[model samples]
Target chain A: MTFRAERRGTFRAERRGTFRAERRGAFRAEVRDQIAKWRRDGVFEPRSDSWLTGYDEDFSRRLGARGWIGLTWRGRGFADRFVLTEELLRAGAPVAAHWIADRQIGPAIARLGSAALKQALLPGIEAGDVRFCLGMSEPDAGSDLASVRTRAVRTDGGWLLDGQKVWSSHAHRATHAYVLARTSTGEHKHRGLTEFVLDMSAPGVTARQIPDMRGPGHFCEVFFDGAFVPDSAVLGSVGDGWGQVTGQLAFERGGPERVLSTYPLLALTLAAAGPADAGRVGELVARLTALRRLGKQVAARMDAGEAPIGAAATLKMLGNRFEVDVIEVARSVPGVPRAAIDDAVLAAPGFSLRGGTTEVLGVVIAREAMGAVG
Target chain B: MSMPDVEEAAVKVLGGAADMRDAARITAEQGWHLLGVPEPEGAGGTLADLTGVVRAVSAAGLSSPLPELHAPVVLSVRGQLIAPWGPAWENVNLAGEPYDIGDAPSSGAVLTRWRILHAARLVGGCQGAAARTAAYAATRVQFGRPIARFQAVSALVAEAHAQAVLAAAGLEAALADPEDDLVAVAALATASRAGTAVARVAHQVHGAIGVTQEMGLERLTRRLWAWRDLPGEAELEPLLGLLGEERAWDLGAGDE
Candidate 1:
């Protein structure tokens, strides 16, 4: 028998048990069905880089209505969520509307928020009724998060937030912003900082778009001048913001998203590739498969209630580098136009820059390793 | 026994097996090679079970004849490599090299299966080296602090660990369908790549000490370089030719 025929038989013969196999099959079907529907309606372009250009609130709601959002919070493990994400990313679906909120914000709130706050916000988040934007990075404090100058001062009713938050992704469109502010000064920079769920529609809050390298200004500069937030808006403990943000980074950095961001280009390259491109293409696929497995393992770790920052950092760094590698390899395949692969290649720089810069992640991993030893 | 049980048991039995002589004694006394054979003839164990044993023995830096001894029988019967045994040298191989046929001609199938096992074992070696190197880096002090405190060292160690994970995962996926030569080829290719990259980084991390014969890393690294081309490109040609051009990239679909 031919090698392909043998492999086809092997694939069919394998059974991964009832619960997992059925769940994975059903999830892939649901995603495929959604993709087909969107294609029919002219809503999603399978060819374009959906992550960069496809931020549809309606699409996010559509997925939410299908109960795809808040997967971890609903007792579906990270592995299950990973399956959902891999299919979405492979299809290049527009998932940016609820990506951050679904990936991290909801989990942070569920873990740290008050019972009343949970009652008020959790359902909306899960249903995609509300979207969230991160308010961590500032004009001067991109990777140096502890240096954020956004100050929250005490008031009779609550606290007043005064300062600017730059690179706040989609803040202009989001309903709420998870703002980290200095509550008080201390000997160390991390102490006395606080996290607040600021209402974007509040009287003193404003957001202006910051055009990135790509055309869309999906990134925004959020401004708050005495925006009054009630005490109930505190997402976690008053002075535990540093720990909270760090915890959220574990969720943000470790996922299929980090590794498979450029997968759409890979898929396109495969469709157009020739015999000559097989070796390089095969190499990329092997690395991607391995990283995907590691990503799932990390997801399982997160599901077990352990926030392994160093492991997550390692995955992000490796995955981000792989993303760039895929772009370079795809560009090399003969007869494929630079124009076809340009968007993904152009968006590639942010892969390493956004979550945490490669240099910063190296330090984080180093510190974690040293700490483990000591 | 189940795959996890096999893994745990092998870890227990081989954790201190250490060298080749020790491994041979344990294998002979325990009939461990029978675990790779099928029902009635020997103990019935899954391919995953056999893979677990390979991983443990490799990680412990011990050598086993189980793959060489059992794979020939399985491959020969299937008419894969050299045809089923002839009378001249039915059981014993006279060639100095472990892979070459003795006085009797054997199919390349035995060599192919042997290389697959070698790839899996190399992955095991990497798992061991990555752990040992990480520990060494974390404790070895330089400039009054652990060298792991430096990005240069930590990144190399982490990168090696990542490669090890990839190799293991790729192997496990290939073993999931042991019958597919295509999967085996891909798995072996990835293993070869990872083993080379990991050995370089490991040596770089350990500096002078890693190269010493006493460190025992050479036991695996030497075999890795030697066995990398056991089947080589010639043996892979039939499978690769059948895989064609575009279907090559789709090999990873099995992994998912």
Candidate 2:
């Protein structure tokens, strides 16, 4: 199976006037060769979602070395990032180590971080030498970010962070933790929150893995007993964390990652299914293709400097549903054993729960859509 | 022009109602039918452009004489058959039903574009119904408070909006490139199903008023059921049948 280079400006002649996808160039050849080499070396198994929880530091660093990590900050648009990410996911590469950094943290730093923070972070991030985990959801906060109780009190030199963060994926393995904590009291719960880029090895900070349905959990519970983060570590302005986090959510939620979690299994099912299962498999591919196209459209809008906040949430919600639906449908495939797809089936529920639960996304999208009509 | 621009223009031209005679008139008066006339027909736009116009017309719940209007114009403009016309469209519905059947052209490009337009219309109709349901729930008082204040009604509205949004995204995806048969099929399937669901929710929210013609909800809801059948399950199966035979499922086909 030969991987074809993406054509430039081929589909959608209607997009002539606005927000054209970045034209394909030499990077196509580069990414194609890299993927081919990885396939030959058997670096990772194809058609597996094991990479979601898998931690291969060297593999991530290899991707960084090949300059595949931070396509966004290196003058490449989201279209380029989409191409690279789709290829990685399709190959089932172990990307969890760099996933957070490459996807959200890196972009967040590049956009909102201070110059000092950016300089210290971007290089390590791009090199895949520094791994980062998101520190958002707290014990009391899951969908409601405005009520986070984690406090980042201003200290003599910097800020003293004290509180607990839950559902932090890969915190135990990450080198740094990007956290949002309350900074000052205000009339609104969303106010007074600030984003912090913390050194995970710092004193007074503790991280413990949380057991989950899937064994060897990637989620972690992080506690801070006055962990000192320098003022330089603060990302964006103090009170502007809400905006920063919202933007980060846009980056985090609206990608191929949301929808393609179970795609490996879906592809596997199609490859191995009998003639009786053809109709179901065909419907699955058709629906998945539509959702993937939707993701690409979101990427194009983001490239054009539009947040498309509502559209992003809508895509993520649909994507979450699609991921779970694919896994459930695969259960009926004739040749594939029910146990064979259990890993993906187990992971299916988390697709929506992790990045803003289905209910939260639904509210966000409905509000935005109704507000637009108003 | 962009689809939004086409949508805006179509809304201004066709308003929110559907009529066969109006479609026939608009096809002749505004040169809407000439949008995708063959290259030899002298000064015709791309199928992508025509697809946008068709999407706009469909979204606004207006009947359109597109590929049907193409035949006479193509013969007059190009002096030859650009594409063969398919069987005439015949469907049953109270909302926007076309009583007079015209020669519906069946060119692959036109068929794909029409299906995309049909999907976009379904999305638009679904969105209209969803908006009405949300508005009704917000205002309709029960137990001394708006029904929308209740989780039951709110959740229904949210689901309706989500369905419409899903269909809209699919339609946008298909509109991006109307040429891909698979994408068109997917778009049609997603939008049609969404449209049907949205129609049901709209009625559920509106109660008996939605069934009465005075509420005018059926104008959008009934059309969704009728138009959904054009590229319905039967039509999608053959295309999907081909997809089922494939060894590898490669959905990463878009240029972007």
The number of the candidate with the highest lDDT is 2
Please give each candidate's TM-score.
Answer: 0.84, 0.87
Worst 10 residues of 2 chain B by lDDT: B73-82
| Lowest lDDT 10-residue stretch of candidate 2 chain A | A1-10
Candidate 2 off by > 4 Å? A1-14, A17-22, A25-33, A47-51, A337-339, B1-22, B38-43, B67-110, B134-147, B234-238, B241-254
Model 2 interface RMSD, one decimal = 10.8
lDDT tens readout by residue for model 2, B1-256: 4346544665667663345656566556655555555434422555555556665565555555554554331111123222222233353345645433333345576566556655666776777778777777777898999777676676677778878777777776665555676677777777777877888888888888888889887777877887676546444633553353232234335444
In candidate 1, what are the lDDT values of residues B1-256, reduced to their tens digit? Answer: 3445555555567556654446555665555555545555555454555666787777766556556555653232223343122223333222112332333444556554555576677788777767677778888899999887777998887767766767886776565445655666767766777777777888898889888989876665665554444443334423442343235434534423
Show the colliding residue pairs in model 1: B81-B107, B81-B109, B82-B106, B82-B107, B82-B108
Off by more than 4 A, model 1: A1-19, A47-49, A363-374, B1-29, B36-40, B73-97, B101-116, B175-182, B227-256
Candidate lDDT scores, in order, read: 0.71, 0.72
Q: How many angstroms is residue A46 displaced in model 1 relative to the true structure, after the best TM-score fit?
A: 2.8
lDDT of 1 by residue, A238-345 (tens): 988898888778888988888888887887776666766666766666566567766766887888888878778878988898888878988888765676588787
Model 2's CAPRI class?
Answer: acceptable
